[model samples]
Target: MKSGGNLEAVLNAGEFAITGELGPPRGTSIEAVREKAAHLKGMVDAVNITDNQTAVVRMASWATSLIVIEEGLEPNYQMVCRDRNRLAMQADILGASALGIRNILCLSGDHQQFGDHPRSKGVFDIDSIQLVNMVKNMRDEGKFLGGDDIDGPPKLFIGAAANPFGEPFEWRVHRLAKKLAAGADFVQTQCIYNMKKFRQWIDEANDMGLTEKIHILAGVTPFKSIGMARYMKNNVPGMDVPEDMIKRLKGAGKGKVATEGIKIACEQIEEFKEMKGVAGVHLMAIEWEHRVPQIVEQAKMLPRPVITPGSGEA
Candidate 1:
């Protein structure tokens, strides 16, 4: 049952697990994959390999995940409904398992309008929630989507995305519950820039006892520059960036802005450590992977835990 790599190992051991994101290279060369994964090797419990993120074409998450494993890193393979139907999705579960992939993150994906291939046809054959349920069924019931028996089902740790800052805020927690109900083992929330709103959302989850049933890692990303902050605030849908945060980043000296960003990220990680219902922090530095070691070390999240067989088993 531990096929999802150390992600399940770390989570089951009840440690504050750290997860990172790695977008696959646009080309086929595996060297690009190794270079990006090198930054996160020991710093994170797992690395989420995005599936054609932002609708832009990239190396397949499944392929990249195998590369991560080759580099001795755990991959949380992301799957989007944009390109695959339920049939393809189910096939991937088996294929990925054969390739030694374990953890999987289900996503509805960014609309095609946002990617380079705007004219690409969208495949809404099944939404993310349904995908979660399907994968759960495959794992638990050992059956294919059409009820055919599987030879050997994939043993995966399921994950879903949540956005605390999205509008109709109070209901966001309920949405998270829906993912859990659909059989999500864990959840990684969207980047949380609005701490106040995230606290509110978390309070709702805690009140409902959802956090106790499933692991929830709050997403944290640092703003590298004034322009980045502005883009997230003004352009990113479902993101809420406060004026104070923008001001702090803008106030920093030109040469020190990146350091300031790291400082801010560390502060959020520190707060996440003490927050109720938060299992850990999901660090998404974007292309800023090099800063991950510094941020986690400064946040005192280094010296990652080691899980033995008896320690992490269900």
Candidate 2:
């Protein structure tokens, strides 16, 4: 076990795990965190706290994750390379560990052009791939990025993002391999609306035995309406929503789109559970945190598996 967090322990115990996300408020109130955490309290192994998702400047992920810990929930703190340089990234890793965070998702964040602060400059001192390897070294080798010794290093369950839907499809699986070689313990992909392509990508990964070495959580988001479906298909980058999916939502009409969306999500969850290489599902229900419990229960994922620490584990 890299960290004593329940997420690693659960996956290590060979059980299918569920993790949800929490997008913190734009301001400083912790009540939003409390309310959202309450909804996902017992339903998920961990709740991912996004760091300024889309670079819109929300509350810091590390600070919000502390509140999640207070709610008795494990946190998957996301850190993006666009906002912080190497020094800040290293400092945040140490700070997060001291505050009891174990899971960290390293990301090459979206450009500021899509964010509220379009005039701000980005600080991509290093890419996501390098960030993953750096975290691995900090945790396993007890050394800083500059090769300086540390009295004690942070224990982290490192993770990286993979966009199986992106272009040059031939290169996606190889990209996953690169991250694995860099020491990413797990990967969560972008929102999945086209399972055929996702399955193919995972198939290639399986052929390479990547699944045996790391946990791959298929990303899923419940579409709220036809407009949302169209937005993702036409506007969202790296999204591959098939025309049939859009037709399914459009066919639902205005009165029942959310209901239809939930059905589609449940169906995908069922399929993901049966996928050969998928170890879990990562639900990125943006601004829809309250719907998580109902979705999980309706999908028959209640009564989460029991995971206890094994030999030589704290």
Candidate 3:
């Protein structure tokens, strides 16, 4: 019942929640946000609004979240530590809550070197785990990081990211445990291409009893082309796109690669539904928001569950 957000309600009700991602436009265009939100409305339990994802500047996540709310959809507001110190971070947290934002995703954003402003200095005042703990304290303890009491605390469903494909595989589950201990209410993993490795990671998480403590939403992203597949495999850190998958995209021939990618994503989502410790799926359609309804329909996850007010708590 924490936050009473749609995402929290769905998970608390034992429904297989489906969340989508919406990257804000590079400029201030309310129509752009609305258009993307239109594609996601009702197709997902919530939509994640990214915060200058991949180090590229864009419309602020909180502002985009409010636009999404106006479009009749819930937003999972994202905050990255790469650009803000504790002062700005806490200020935004309070503002986001006052704006009715219910879910917040804490992240250590991609390094500035990867973005348009390569020379920008990062303000990594605190890491993602610490961000999670700070948010939790603000919500539950009604106090700031420096121990000052807040008149009104943010009521948010806290979330953190995980990469099952991250190297030194043995350490993945432990990292998740750290976030859980930091009071993360839910987790969304990196896009899963290697099912075997992902299953192993989740199995270890289950073994440690972490699943009982937090909700894990398996991440899924559809490849638009073989080039995209290869880029993710060869370039994106912590992204494990197996060669066979790239081959599958290539096998789709010239005009059909996107279709095949959606098929692959749908298949992976089906498997996640059956996997233990997976509470739901986080569909990162990545500018392909128009295809989300089709993917949900094809995966038979349509007609997302309706959670009544006050039904989230027992």
Top-scoring candidate (lDDT):
3
| Winner by lDDT between candidate 3 and candidate 2 | 3
- What does candidate 1's lDDT look like per residue over 63-109, in tens digits? 99998999988999999999989899999989998888889999999
Per residue, candidate 2 scores C-alpha lDDT tens digits across 39-64 of: 99999988899999998999999999
Q: Find the candidate with the highest TM-score and give its number.
A: 3
Q: Rank the models by lDDT, top first.
A: 3, 2, 1
TM-score of candidate 1 on Cα atoms, chains taken together? 0.98
lDDT values of the candidates? 0.90, 0.92, 0.95
- lDDT by residue (272-310, candidate 3, tens digit) is 999999999999998899999999999999899998988
Q: How far is candidate 1 from the true structure (C-alpha RMSD, Å)?
A: 1.1
TM-score per candidate, chains pooled: 0.98, 0.98, 0.99
Report clash pairs, candidate 2.
none
